[model samples]
Target: MARWEIKNVRIAGVAAAVPRNVVYTTDFDFFTLEEAEVFNNTVGIKQRHIAPEDVCASDLCFAAAEQLLADLKWERESVDVLIFESVTGDYKTPPTSCLLQDRLGFSEDCFSMDIPMGCCGCMYAITTGGNLLSSGNAKRALLLVGDTALRMGSMKDKSRVPLFGDCGTAMALEYNPTASDIVVDFHTYGKGYEALMTPHGGFRRPITKESFEYEDFGNGIVRAPLHTLINGMNVFSFAISKPPRSIETFMADYRIDRERDVDYFLIHQANKMIVDRIVKKLKLPLEKVPYNLEEFGNLGGASIPSLMVTRLRKQLMTEEKSLLMSSFGLGLTWGTMWLRTQPMVVSELVIL
Candidate 1:
């Protein structure tokens, strides 16, 4: 079973950062005004934060991490672990987490690693970090997740471009015996891998001159071999089918009562249709489901955490809350995380 409870892993705080530049749906050059309106209403993505040419996912995470560490009033060396999750890394060679560890000035002995899972990243990284602290090997851990997803899409591809935005998030966890346990369950469907992926740039399919040529794939999706391509129908069918079953399994397996046990449910911001469908299928209250995907496009793994910083910021900062977080998308992986958060520091939304 890919389901278990991690004990005594307390959520200490969270912080997030997004690019300063804004691209309103109507202003997106790829979409005509009428098409843009349809996209905004249908997908519920009103604006996107496009990162500048020089900035990378690591840079965004660094800014968020730096601010969070300060707000939490923790010294650099006191941190014991750092987990970074992103697909758009600094390089394909050196893991970006290594660069962040040095850049963040953590202790030389701090455990650091990289997680490149796509949309399920936040929970996966958090669960990994939480397990590390729960094992008594570490006292405090940092989980950083983000994606410059816009960088992966072809600008001219209407389906790809408007559906992505850039964001980085930092979550701090601590070992506290009395704190509530963080329950997490993850499931993977490797068979659906090609449903959303870049077919080149990896060792198996090294990039060549032809990798740069964008091909019109019959629909609005046009992309190079090096760029990520999503089979929308495949992804949509999987999204609508798998996640609902997964959520039901969690609720049954874990004895979760949505009305009684949870304060909020933050599912992946894949789009408004997917979100609304899952919510309706699960019978989750729309009021209790907090979604801010419209403010920033589908942020891959960072979507849920981004919500904690933006939509539910004041409430979370002022009071204790229990949240059910799930993200299902790219990589064909998804996870459900139940977090009991105390009144914690949530940094102001950073515009980098």
Candidate 2:
């Protein structure tokens, strides 16, 4: 685990853009009526927004970034850094961040890059952006984190299909000398990467003749080599343990009392049971944590920012808040970050 604190930076605003298309769990083609009902009642995801085949993760992030910049009323040329994090890139060669910088009309001088990560990308991206701003070199930065994760799901893969929701999210960070600082903690267990992964398509495995072949693992779990696979038990166990442990350690390390110092715990919208367990372990008040899963489903790295727009938009726009956000999954990663938010532009959810 690596821990750090960023100084002289604050959140300016946040925005989320999801596909206009919605897929209700009841409409799941692969599940029998009884199966869908059981899954829905257990997972608590009634529906999810899924991007079409033509839409890339960058497109959603682009929409979100546009809305965020517009609501923030910040000139494009003023944003000195743009970091795009996603598992879905537009191309195998060019970083998605570079393409976003160009599309967003940012100046040529803006430093743009990509962090190819999954659910925990948000915390890491914010840490990077905040530190860059704190250095007094970049006054403003965009931290983009999202994924069309479901795009990699096989339509017949029961273990994954019904659980994923697609979305892209953006956050604006501005250097402010007097603003509250940011504290972040990161933990990565690469050994367990197989717990959730797309076995082929990348250079490691490359595209083979069998890569596109679909195999049915009974119980409706079917997928090609190119699709994502999951070890539910592995992820669920980590979700209920690693994240809460990290959050608890972070609080103790920073001497933060949840009741006294934090306003909300915005966790990744992965699983309902996972969220409840972490909340219980930390002894956190239910009201202190906001969930977007029931409406938006699990949004991977986009959960935190999307949760801000969908659940706490008005409060974030009208008052100062101390927020603790935790996200864990894919890459077998988990992280928790704490930040104080000053009343700022919180945009209405953008449908792309």
Superposed by TM-score, candidate 2 places the C-alpha of residue 246 at a distance from the truth, in angstroms, of 1.3
Q: lDDT score of model 1?
A: 0.89
TM-score per prediction, in order, is 0.98, 0.97
Question: Which prediction has the highest lDDT against the true structure?
Answer: 1
Q: Which pairs clash in model 2?
A: none
Model 1: residues >4 Å from true position, as ranges?
none
TM-score, model 1 to reference: 0.98
lDDT of 2 by residue, 1-352 (tens): 5888899998998999999999998898877899778877778898899899999899999998998888889999999999999988898878988888889999999999899778888888898888889988889999988899887878888888877899999999999998987988888989989999989988899999999999988877989999989889998988898889988989998999999999999988897888888889899999999987877788888888899999999999998999999999887889989988999888889997
Could you tell me how far off, in angstroms, the CA of residue 200 lies in candidate 2 after the best superposition?
Answer: 0.6
- lDDT tens readout by residue for model 1, 166-229: 9999999999988888888888888889999989989899989999998887657678899888
Q: Which ten residues in a row have the lowest lDDT in candidate 2?
A: 35-44
